[model samples]
Target: MNYTLLNSIIVIYVGLIAYLGYLGYKHTNSTKDYLVAGGEINPFIMALSYGAAFISTSAIIGFGGAAGAFGMGLLWLTFFTIFVGIFIAFVFFGKRTRQMGQNLEATTFPDLLGKRYDSNLIRAFSSLIIFVFMPLYAGAVLIGAARFLETGLGISYITALIVFTAIITVYVTTGGLKGVMYADAFQGSIMFLGMAFLIIYTYVQLGGFTNAHVLLTDMVHLVPAKLQAIGHQGWTSMPKFGSALWWVVISTLVLGVGIGTLAQPQLAVKFMTVKSNKSLNRATLIGGIFIFSMTGVAFVVGALSNAYFFKNFGKTALEMVGGNFDKVIPLFIKTCMPEWFAYIFMLTLIAAAISTLSSLFHVMGASIGKDLYESMITKDNRGSQKQSMFLIRTGIVAGILLSLLLGYILPISIIARATAMFFGIAAATFLPMFMLGIYWKGVTRIGAISGMFTGALSSIFWLVFIHKKEAVALGISQAIFGKPFLIETFPWMVVDPIIVALPLSLAVTIAVSFFTGNTAIQPPHLKKCFEGIG
Candidate 1:
């Protein structure tokens, strides 16, 4: 591969995103415009922006790495993403979210929930959680993309990180949500197309899908002895039931991401960017198709990479990637694809990274400015558009710096786990509150607060005190619980914080609402939310 050409393509790609950001800056005139694109984004851009944010470097590099380590069993995640994350999300949550957001005139996730409950505390606290926890997710995404560049293009990790982060931050800070959405639509298309091409090319290079599978199966004994001891036989096949690897794949990777999608603040906010239920409906097919191709191809190619490596290097794909796990797909592309295709794939990877990063940064800024700064810190400051925009850009810079620092210090081995931890926390804390607050009138501020607190704390506690890696890192003994948290007893996985916290939050909200006699006044705007939507 000509290094100069690769560098040139990257520079050109980033230049286009900057140009889009400049256009967005021209259109941004108010606080609402900065935060939610003035709620005028088209359904197609909304759909692609949602997809791009959802399918990040974490999904492609991190999950593909998991597939390399765990086998095709992780494919269940791809299925859940289409059926649960997209199909159900669009049909059930999308329209109501848009309607309610518009009714309340909200610009961020925290603002939506806070206004729905008439509680500034809810808004401020939720903003704090997002600002604090989002960096871990952001850092993980940064690491995944940077690792790919380091492995595939022989670039320094620091250089890759800085370049990728700078480009995303520039557009996000300048153009806000509108710029991010436009760039996401373009980048998302590249990701979808690149993944499809990579899958087809990988199959062809391995002598078709059937031959690839057979070769993968023939090398079953090549599975790492440690993995074999835990029942993993090969990269192409599923792990044996009731094994450690099986549990990790089922409980953590599949459920973590699938359930986590519903609560992702960045993705959920996209549902509010468009105007009507019809817009959300139109976006459903686009989002579903995008996810199916993007995630589906990543898992399929990840599994098949075993064949590529086994044939060429006499070792498994994971071995070739130096146990970094995230490098498997990038390495496969570098070794198997033509130089030109590799160049295209590099653009796709960068596009995936930058698109997701931009959205994350935008959501974080909105959370701070609209939810906390305006509502709580300056409760009497009378919502001035200029002041709000100033706070938002300030938050954007602060967020980027924090994420960069965390990415530098966090251990690479647990980056995937860290990413999963964030998703799990979101699922536990926000999913129940959002779902019930919209559908169930009995959801009081007290109940919503209780649920968010319980879910967020319990999930973090389990990850830190009970997870093997965290336990070891913190010098805590896991034997205190007799096994890893959620790995013991029936319904544990189902009762994991997300499951427990959500229902508990709902139950508390209902019980408390009834006990308190539904005393709080419901805003007239709340009723208007459902009007004209059915």
Candidate 2:
């Protein structure tokens, strides 16, 4: 509608990002700088980068849409985002991870585990998992941003995806960790401002906060019959406890991403980007505030969007989005917000997508270059440092291509489910090893490997064969089992893989460690992982 002003804002945003990328490229001279910013990142930058990387377009566009469909009950995830994702992650996990990563000279999440246990197989396996599965998560982020451009600005979806991917790949491929984090910090600021204004303005538009929520509560009778059959209650309240929608929202969306955030390889590696514990301690406040505003406002606004749409258009947000939940926020912004605010918020969405995409590509590249290929070459005494960096750069390109392909092919309304799937898989595969490796001296290499394999494999199996999203989408269960899903039981069809996979992984690790008779070889470097221990 207002092309001139929108174009100017975009140009300025792009220029600022390019300048940050230049600074990153200038500072990044060696492999160490490329991979971990030489372990000397500013505390403020690290905190902002961590928060930005963690809450991407997937959270704002994807999960926000989910909130619009499912209701304000999604606020439980906000609580978890603050307490678990920020506070506990920084205080408990971040401190130990940084200390151990520094002690072990580890540059990646998989490298930390492999070095901690002195097992090359563990490192390579975990890295391979990242190289393969991370694209699904990256694709979700790509789709979220791309969909916004397509829906809000009338850009071609293919053009949006390619352009977004191209810009991010350039900065990430050149500037490395420094470039990624610097850009992330700037983008995070934009996102924080955009979401803050969004929530405040939304409330003002729909009367006061209390009146808006009360109106929403009164619209429970307007819910679709199909949704009610599946347990959706009201926009202002939770679904029936233990109902199908309840299980999907709680077990899949909430627990999947909430608890799963602890083991995120991309985010975990951020702990090692800084120099000391004080940086992490300082980060806690920044990270907490960022996550709270980002997620809290998103959920509140998303749920309120339904009310806004219903009142204005006499139709639900879901109906307006044409069954594609991911389009709800973009549609809201395009139709409701002032033209200038719409342009500014467009930059915010782009920032969110680019920040997360940069981190994902970096992690994917390092996993392949430093962990998989480099580990093999070093094991055979044939690895050159230059060759390792080349391999990682190659991996970054490959990862981006795969994600672009997935973004093109994935079905509509898949952003939230796809995001959950990645987080759940990461939690199942890596959480046990990461948590125990940091705190428990008795954790054996064999135990960790077994848990890792079991967790990863079982999660994939369940997703492919049992989870409703994949099964129904692929038509595999319908073909094989004469049903939309393989598991016909209640809650099973709705339950996320993490609920089953994570516990089995934890149990297997503990059992294997106990049965194998605490013959753990605690090397000096490994012992340094735990402070005040022999």
Candidate 3:
């Protein structure tokens, strides 16, 4: 690959994003505009932005690497992403969210929940959770992109991390959500098109799909002895029932990310950006198609790359990629694709990173500044648009700095797991409250708070104390209370924290709400906001 050409293309792409950020700044006038793009974003841009924010470098790099390690079985995640994350999200959640958001005059996720229930505690606590946990998600995304750069371009990880973070922060702080959305739309298009091409090119390079599968099957007997001994088959074939890999893929990766998308603060907030339910309906088709292509292609290409590497090097692609899992896709791209295509792929990867990072930072900023700060510290200063915008920008900077620091400190091997952990936590904590709050008027403040706290705390406790990595990191024995944390008979994969926590949260929410008295007092502006929108 021509380093000069690759570097030049990246520079041009980033410069263009910077220019777009400047344009977004010009359009940003009030806190509403900064936080929600004036709630007038085009449906196409809104859909693309939603997809871009949802499918980060984590999806392409982190999960794609996961596909390499786990095989095509992880493709179930793509199906769920389209059906659950996109279709259900838009059809079930989007319209109600838009109506409720407008009705409550809410700009951030926390704002919607707090104002919906008329609880300052909800606003402050929700903001606190987002500010604290979102950085871990953001850090994982940073590691995904930086790991690609280190593997693909031979750049230092720290340097790549700094550069990528700096570029995204500059745009996000200046351009706000509208800027982030516009950039995301553009970057998302590149991601979709680039992945489509990469998939096709990979198949062709491997002497077509049939031959590739045949080759992979023939090499089944060559499966690592250790893996085979552990009940692993070939990469082309699915894992055996009760296998460790099988459980991890199905439970943690697929279910974790697939179900988790509904509660993502970054994606959920996007539903509030559109003008109407009709816009959200329209976006559903666009988002579904885009996600299907981007995620589907990544998984297909990742699986097929194994065949290609084995043909050339007499070893699986994972062997050449240094077994880091995160490096698999980058290694595949560098070795298989032409220099020009690799350059474009690099741009696509960067676009994925920056687009998602911008959205994450923007949401984190809004949660901290608009939702928490204005509601708590500056409630009386709501009329001061300039002051609120300044605070939001300051929050963006703080979020970027915190995430960067976390990215620097977190171990690279577990980057993908960390990313999955964030999503799992978000789903467990926010999904029930968000969904029930929109549709069920009986949802009390105590119910919401209990659900949020239980879901969030339980998810974290499982990931930290009960998870295998945490056990190893903390030097604790895996056998606790006879077998793991909660239940002995149930598999760890079956009883993942998200599975446990989400239901528990919902149960607690209903139980507490029924027992406690209602604190419901609809906001004065509710009817005015909901009157015209159907």
Q: Which stretch of 10 consecutive residues in model 1 shows the poorest summed lDDT?
A: 488-497
Tens-digit per-residue lDDT, 36-124, candidate 3: 89999999999999998888888888888877766787788999999999999999888988888887778898888788777788788
After TM-score superposition, what is the CA distance of residue 200 in candidate 3 from its true location, in Å?
Answer: 0.6
Model 1 per-residue lDDT tens digits across residues 423-459: 8788877888788877876666787787778777767
Q: Estimate each model's TM-score.
A: 0.93, 0.97, 0.93
Error of 2 at 57 (Å): 0.7
Encode model 2's per-residue lDDT on 1-534: one tens digit a residue: 888887889889989999999999899878888888999999999999999999999999999999999999999999998899999899989988998888888889999999988889999999999989999999999999999999878989999998888887787888889988999999999999999999989999999889899989999998888889989999988999989899999998999999999999999999999998999999999999999999998888889998899889998889998888999999999988888998899899999999999999999999987788766755577556677778888999999999999999999998989989999999999999899988887888889999999999999888877888787788876788787777778778778999999999999988897777455455565666665322
Sorted by TM-score, highest first, which candidate order results? 2, 3, 1
Q: Model 1 segments beyond 4 Å from truth?
A: 476-507, 517-534
Question: How many backbone clashes does every candidate have?
Answer: 0, 0, 0
State residue 503's C-alpha deviation in candidate 2, in Å.
0.6
- Order the candidates by lDDT, highest first — what do you get? 2, 3, 1
| Candidate 2 CA-lDDT value | 0.90
